[model samples]
Target: MNPYVIVSILVAYFGVLMVIAYFTSRNADTQTFFTANKKSPWYLVAFGMIGTSLSGVTFISVPGNVGNTQFAYFQFVLGNLVGYLVIATVLMPLYYRLNLVSIYTYLEQRFGFWSYKTGSFFFLLSRTIGAAFRLFLVAAVLQIGVFQQWGIPFSVNVLITIFLIWIYTFQGGIKTIVWTDTFQTFFLVSAVAISVYLISKELGLSLGQMVATVRESEYGQIFHWDPKSSKYFWKQFIAGAFIAIAMTGLDQDLMQKNLTCKNLQDAQKNMLSFCTVFVVVNLLFLTLGALLYLFAESRGIAIPGRTDYLYPTLALKSFGLLAAVFFLLGITASSYASADSALAALTTAFCIDFLNFDKRTEEDRKKIKFRVHVGFSVLLYLIILIFEALNDESVVTAVFTAAGYTYGPLLGLFAFGMLTRLPVRDRFVPLICVISPILCYIINKNSEAWLNGYRFGFEILILNGFLTFLGLLLLSKKRVAEPEVIPGE
Candidate 1:
């Protein structure tokens, strides 16, 4: 509960990260920063990615979501596994074959310059906000847990948080993250596992008793068979699958790490292994969630105003000092893992896709890359301030809502390009992509009135992608003389 103790933990954590940055970032260049010179081991990449994929959002939001949604999230977790398979089999092979630095470059090769820019722009927008959203949640928790007690402003907390991430990441980029994230993931998973143990102990349950207790608890319901609920099994399953593909396979922030591996087989192995770890990790979070609620009921504590507040509330207030230690470490590790990688990826996307990093002289390239990296850290800081001012709902929901719109166009663009051979009118590509999300938004906003009270859930992402696919279909021209696809050069 002491702010000084929390501050001590943070100082030590960043000290270790800076040391890693020092060693790994030495003599690193644009190639090293962007793809770690394609020298990262497959297993290390796999291990580190588990942290990036979970983020601070999962660290807090998923556990809290259990209060309202129950184990229904596990359905979405199941969908993520399906999505990971799609990425491994369908997407990674294409990225490897083309030797892409920015995955969006594939759009340029397939469609035209405008499509390429559109895809990159969407990634920049989606990841910028998504990363900020993740950071915002952690910043808020830290603010509550530490800074607010010390009279520090929320903006200062955000600035400091992003600043620390920028410090370690600005030099080494993905090269640094491949190792740093592995270190962070260890603490992240340990925090969750320990939190579960502590909470169960508070309730006087052993590991076996904890399992039986959660299985019988009201919060333990994992499946929602009701067709009308947003958490419906099939709906969440399908949405989760597509979200994994759109947000991961199609996302540069994630695939950039995968791209750092030595070859296609190594990358595929990373994806598969990461997928297995991801499923297990999320299951652990859900189990922790059930325990948090049961612990709350046992202690006669009121659930916090926001479900997002539930885990932190229990960890900081209900659980002992040791739980608080894990809470701070876990949240900090998870948040840094994702945010640091995002800062690197945004710089990579801008430099490669927008700034022509490949053509610039090495010296000029370094200058521009450094500036872009700083610019994004500032950009994220500003967005988190905005979100702090405006966000009222569960952040996890806000994240997915934003994703359904932003990532949907990406999904459609890639699907149309990969699945269909028809060439699009390259000039109209940007317009179609723009119109798809707007149309999806209007439909989603008015769905109940327009669609007879049928609500749109994460499945809305599927419709958003379908609309873009249809828009692209209308823009499709006659098949060109079989444009040469990448031959896995």
Candidate 2:
């Protein structure tokens, strides 16, 4: 519970990451940073991705969310299972065939210059906001757990947080992230597993009794059948599939890891392996959530007003020093695991997608990559400050909500390119992508009133993508009979 201990744990943890970065990055060049020289182990990528995918949001929010939503989030996880299958079978193959450094280049091949840029732009936007939201949760926790004791400002906390990520990632990039995330994921998963055991011990429940207690408790419910509620099973399941496709399959931060694999088959294997683990890990989070709520009720501890605070509050103030240490480690590992990857992917995307790094000389590429990495680091820092000013909702909910709008166009763009043979008005692609999310925002805001009390949940992403798809359709034309040769094919 001591603030000094929390700081020491954090310092020591980063020290380890610095060591890893140094070794992994020793002979690193742009190729090593961008694609890990296309030699990352499938199993390592699969395992490390657990930390990247879950991040701090799941570490804190999902379990805390159990008090309110119970196990309904699992429905979404099931949907994610289906979505991951789609990614493995469908999306990954296309990315592999294209030999894409940035997946957005597929858009350029399929559609045109504008469409490619549009897809990459949305990725940049979606990832920036999403990463900031994740880091904000961890930063808020650090402030309360360590900085607040020392009277440090939140702005200083944000800078320090982003700087740690940049320092480790600036050289090794995805190569460093692949290994560091694996290490962090071990701690992340262990933290939850150990916390669950400690809570069971505190509650005097055996393993069987713990399962039975969670199963029988009010928080155990996982399905909602109501057609209008956001948690409706079908809605969440379907949304989960598309969310996986859009956020992971379509995302650069995640796909960059996948692309680092030696071949398409390895990437597919990685995805399938990751999917099974992803589902099980989420269920574990849901179980931990139920246990947390149960522990709170039994101990007469008041849940915090912000559910995001519940886990940190108990671990720091109630559970002994051991829980506090793992909680800090788990959160830090999970958060930076995701954040560091995002920083690398952001740099990679900008350098490759926007800056034409491939066309540049080696020395020029090095300087540009360094500056862009630093630029995005500063950008993330600024956005976290903005989130602290404006955000009032659970971070998980906010992330999904934002993804619904931002990633929707990516879903739409990819679907249009793959599902249809029609040639689009390439110049008009940006306009359609822009209009889709704005329309989604309007529809979501008035859905309950306009649709007879129908609340939009994660399914809003599906609707957003559909609207974008439709918009693209309107702008499409019958394909010319001439066989078109894609550049570099």
Candidate 3:
């Protein structure tokens, strides 16, 4: 709990990452930065993705959220399982067949210039915000755990956070992330597993007793059937599927790692393996949540109003030195694992999709990539400061809510291109994408009042995508004679 100790842990953690970056990034060029030269081991990618997918939001918020939402989030997790299947079976094949460096290039090949740009633009928006939200969690915790004790302002804390990420990632990029993430995932998983054990030990409960206590507790319920409620089982399940598809399958940040695998089969194996581990890890977090609450109640600790604060407060103040240390390491690992990849993906997308990296000389490409990477890092720092100023609700909720609006167009664009042979008026694509989310916002705000008290949750993403799809359909003409085909396919 000492500020000096926290600083020591952080310095040591980043030191490990920098060492990994050094070895993995040596002799690294553009291909290595963008695709790890397509040589990453599938198993390592699968294992590392667990940390990237969960991030700090899951590390803290999911457990704390168990008090209010119970196991209801499991419905969303079930949907995520389905979504990952779609990504593996449907999207990954398409990406591999086309041999894309940036998946958004599919939009260009399938549609036109505007559609490709539109898709990439949405990705930039969605990932920038999503990554910022993830980093904000770690920044806030660092502020409370270390900087606040030193009277350091939150803005300065955020600057320090972003700088650390930029330093390790700027050179090796995705090549560095694949290795570092695997190392960090170990700490992240261990922290949660050990924290749960410590809590049970403190309460004088055996493993079986701990399981029984969580099951019988009021926070253990996992399904809601009310159609009008946001947490309805079907709504959450269906929304979870689409959220995974849109956020992971369509977004470059996640899919970039998948692309780094050698071939389609290897990528598929990575996804399926990641899906199985993803579910088990989430269940562990939920279990930890229930235990945190029970531990608090028995000890007469007042629960924090913002559930996000609950995990950090208890870990630092009451859970002993060991728990606090792992808590800090777990959050740092989860946050950086996701953020570093996001930075690489953003740079990759801009270079390939926007700047025509393929057409440029290698030397010119490197220079541009460096500037773009730095630009995004600074952009993320600003966004986190802004989020710190405005965020009021749970971060996990805010992340998905923002994704619902931002990623909706990507879902629609990909869905429209794959499912139909018709071409759209090229220039109008961006307009359709823009108009879709605005209409979705209006519909969501009035859903309960106008739609017979039907409240919207993550399903808003589905609606947003559908609206964009319909808007594109309205602008389409007669179908072409034949669909375009790749040479090998």
Candidate 4:
């Protein structure tokens, strides 16, 4: 593959997005920047979310998983189905009732400033780390495909990539994100669909043959009963459910779009719309993986140790020009879809939550937004540098594991407040949330010694939630000042 050609294509693609950023981001108010004026077409938000949720990490990672990582990624989607239901019914109502600008505001009402700040801090930390990792995976490809080919350092490449994201998002933030994400999502999925068909053709299998092969393979089985292991079916399914709700429902990047729906009824429709697309799109990617496996077997292609490279390698090896372009375009589209929105949301949350820009004058708001945007770009870039230094398959996996801890408290805090009418001790709220997760981590680490090699899996979320719930029971004292919910029209 001519790396120059790929680089040129990517540069051109970004130029197009910048043009988009210029127009969509014009005359932005704070409300417009943060929530698209809370009037984005719900259907469009639903479509755009496919891009945000399924990053380049997912683009490369999910299909490759089918052959290497037990193919149980599909089972996670099953959990997602249940998770989406809970979010639509449970989380959505709470968010709507509060008419919250930032989701973490609910923590303030349920607990206090300390707890509110605590939750937002976790979200900021977790999201920054999580977004960096996602971009890190895409960075690996860019480093190889563009920068290295042009004799540029990977760090330089990372800076430039993040810089581009920052450039477009600074003006409009989420307002620009919803529409840009829709464009990126379309390209990403289209690229995947094209590459899959081309790869299938090269393998000499029609689409029908490919589907039949996957259904018969070991990778296709969706359920497992062994609770003792991480790959076991039920643990994963349950884990998948919790992961979906926590990551998607509680996540600002995803939920911000949900909140943009014109009304609760429309928002509910958007969730269902997103859910259906999520399942179908994942199935398409899985089928692409199955096709790759069958093709490799038929031609005796040596599969790489890292399953993530399957799509790229196959594209490069077979039917040269079109396949390579398809692979590159798909991967690029996937990365930008998620990463750009991430930059927007990170800026939105920090500006809204911690900075209290609502209290500031217009000039101060712009000044603070600029400084914060620049600072975060630097911070996220540094994290990507470390991610590159570690540069192993398991390193990205570990990054996810670490971020997983942050969600444990989010789950616990939100569950306690929403499910129970009981007041949480406002003063101790932050302390309890912090303590519960750390203790959960300790128990998770020592479980082998504590229970004779008994390790926790997805159910650790349940434990973490339970501990926070118990702590809330122990700590909460006076009822809050009159509930802060303002009546909606």
Candidate 5:
């Protein structure tokens, strides 16, 4: 609970990451930064991805979300399982065969320049906002938990957090991130486990008893069949599958790490392993959420207005110093693990997709990349500030809604490229991508009146993609001969 102790822990944490970056980055070049020279171990990449996929949002929100949604989120988790399988069997092979550094390059080769840029821009827009929102959550937590007591401004906390990420990632990029994420995943999971154990102890329950309690609690209810509810099983499951494909298979931040594996087979293995572990980790978070509510009920404590605040408030005020220690460590690990990787992916995308980093001399390339990297860092800093000034919704909700809009176009573009052989009117590809999200926004806003009271959820991504797919079809021409099919079917 002491501010000095929290600062000390943070300093020590960044020191370890910096040391890791120093050694990994020795003699690193652009290839090493972007692809880790394609030598990352499958096992490490798999483990590390657990951190990147979850982030601070999942660390806090999923469990916190249990109070309102109950176990309904489990439906989405099941959907993610199917989505991962699709990525492993389909997308990974295509990416490896193409030998892509930035996955959007597939668009340029398959469609044309405009489609390629459109895809890359969607990624840039989606990831920039997603990563900034995540960093914002961490910065806000640190500002309240540690800095306010020391009379530091929120802006300073945001700057320091982003600066730490940049310091370690600026050198080795994916090479450093692949390893650091693995280390952070350990602390993040450990924090949840410890919090679970301490809460059980406070309630005087053994591990078995704790499990029993959570299983029987009202918050543990998982299945939902109501058509009107957003968390209904089929809706969540189907949406989760498409979300995984769109966000992970199609996302540069995640795929960048996947591409670092030695080969296609290794990448598939990593994805499968990551999928299995991801399910287990989420179960732990849900159980912790149920137990938190139970603990509060037994002690007669009032639940916070925002469920996101539940974990932090209890850890700092209700649990003792030890719980606070792990809470800080866990949140920092989760937030930085995702944010740092995203920063690297954003830099790689801009340099390759826009600036053509490969065309320049080695000396010139490095200078351009360094400046671009700094530029993205500044962009992320500004976005987080904007979010702080205006955000009123739960961050988890905001992130998925934003993804539905930004990542939707990417989902449509990739789906059209892979699933069809027709070539679109090249110049119109960007317009189609742009219009798809706007149409989606309008439809979503008026769903109740326009669609007979049908409320859209994350599945809005699927609808957006379909609209884009239809738009592409209108602009497309069938190949003269048998069309070239995507490699992995």
Candidate 6:
């Protein structure tokens, strides 16, 4: 891969994105930016979600995990299916009934200002950090692999990369994102599919043979029923489900796209479609990993130390320049798709929940939205740099762990509202939500001793939620409402 060629492709690719942002920004007043006027086509929303659900993390991390992150990760995918059902049946109805622009407003309506702030705060803390970390993975590749070798400063590359995300997403929030994300998913999935075909071709294997090969690989195992560790079957299964629920169903970033759909059925349809594509897309990446490992075995190319790099390095080795071009485009698409949406969601949540800008007109709110968008971009820039400075473990692993901690409040809020009948003290709800994860962290830190040598699985979300639920339980008063319980039993 020529350095100049890679840079040129990246430049051209982002130029397309700028056009998307510019045109979308044309009529992107507050409502158009935030809500897409609630007129976006469901099919397009569904299509765009494919990219949001799977980011550059999915592009790089999913396949890499096929070999390294254990074979049992498919348990998470199964959990996602369950979580989507929960979202469709439970969360969507509530959102639709209330007609929420920022979903956190439901917290205020249900539990009061405290709960609303709690939900929004958790979203900001977790999402901002997670998005920054995600963008960092792509930045690492572009900076060290591309820019550093080309004598461009790493900071400058990071700035340019993040600036591009803000440029496109700062306008038309959910509305612009729907179309651009659709465009991005096209190249992202197509590039992966083409690379898969080429890889299969190189090995002289048909699609069936490719599938067969992965099935035979060590990465094929999808379940481990142990309750004691991260691989425990039921534990992982539930944890995986909540991860999907929190990260996708509950998180504003993913749901913003889903919310753009015209109705709950459409959003549910979008979720099902996204999940269907997700399973296959992951299989595609896993199969690619199997092929790459096989290729390495055949050609004696030493695999990289980090499995995450397997795809990029393998693509570099196995494909021609044109394929490489598509590979970078895929990377750009995946990274930007998730990152841009996150920024938009963060800004939307801030404007709606914290600032109450929904009551204001577009002319009065435009500057505020732009300022918040830029502020988030800078916040993410700082976080990504910190991750770089630390230079610790894999960024993807950190992301999964962060999801457990950050999304705990979402799980807690929903569980408290749905599973219990206690009337929450609205003013104290935020404190309860805030205390839950930190308590979880402390318990998680000392669990080995606290649980009498019973350790927790890496999906600490279960514990986080239970802790939050318990806190809410303690804070909430059992109030007898007019018996309106529906006869589900």
TM-score of each: 0.98, 0.98, 0.98, 0.93, 0.98, 0.94
Global lDDT for candidate 1?
A: 0.91
Candidate 6 lDDT by residue in tens digits, 380-469: 998888888885655567888888888887888877776655667778777777787788889878987877765665478878888888
Summarize candidate 4's per-residue lDDT along 390-483 as a digit string, tens digits.
7667433555466557777888778777766667667787788788889989999999899776777656776776797889877766655344
lDDT of 5 by residue, 1-489 (tens): 788888899999889999999999999998899999999999999999999999999888887888888888889999999999999988888999889999999999888899999999999999999999889878877987898998999888899999999989998999999999999999999999999999999999999998888888888788888786788788899999999999999999999999999999899999999988999999999998898899889999998887887888898789999999899989999999999999999999999999978889988878988998999999999999999999877788889999999998899988888887788888999899889999999999999898777788889999999999999999897773134437654
| CA lDDT scores, all candidates in order | 0.91, 0.92, 0.93, 0.79, 0.90, 0.78
Off by over 4 Å in 2: 480-489
Q: Residues 1-489, candidate 1, lDDT per residue (tens digit)?
A: 888999999999999999999999999988899999999999999999989999999999999999889899999999999999989988898998888999999999888899999999999999999999999978988999999999999999999998899989988889999999999999999999999989888889999999998889888998998787788899999999999999999999999999999999999999998888898899899999999888888878998888888998779877889999999999999999999999999999999999888998989989999899999999999999999889898989999999999999999999988877788898898888888889988998898899777678898889989998999899799876255654332
lDDT of 2 at 83: 91
What's the C-alpha lDDT at position 132 in model 2?
Answer: 97
lDDT of 1 at 60: 95
Whichever of 4 and 5 has more lDDT, that candidate is 5
Give the true-structure RMSD of model 2.
Answer: 1.7
lDDT of 2 by residue, 47-108 (tens): 99999999999999999998888999999999999999989988888888878899999888
Q: How high a TM-score does candidate 6 get? A: 0.94
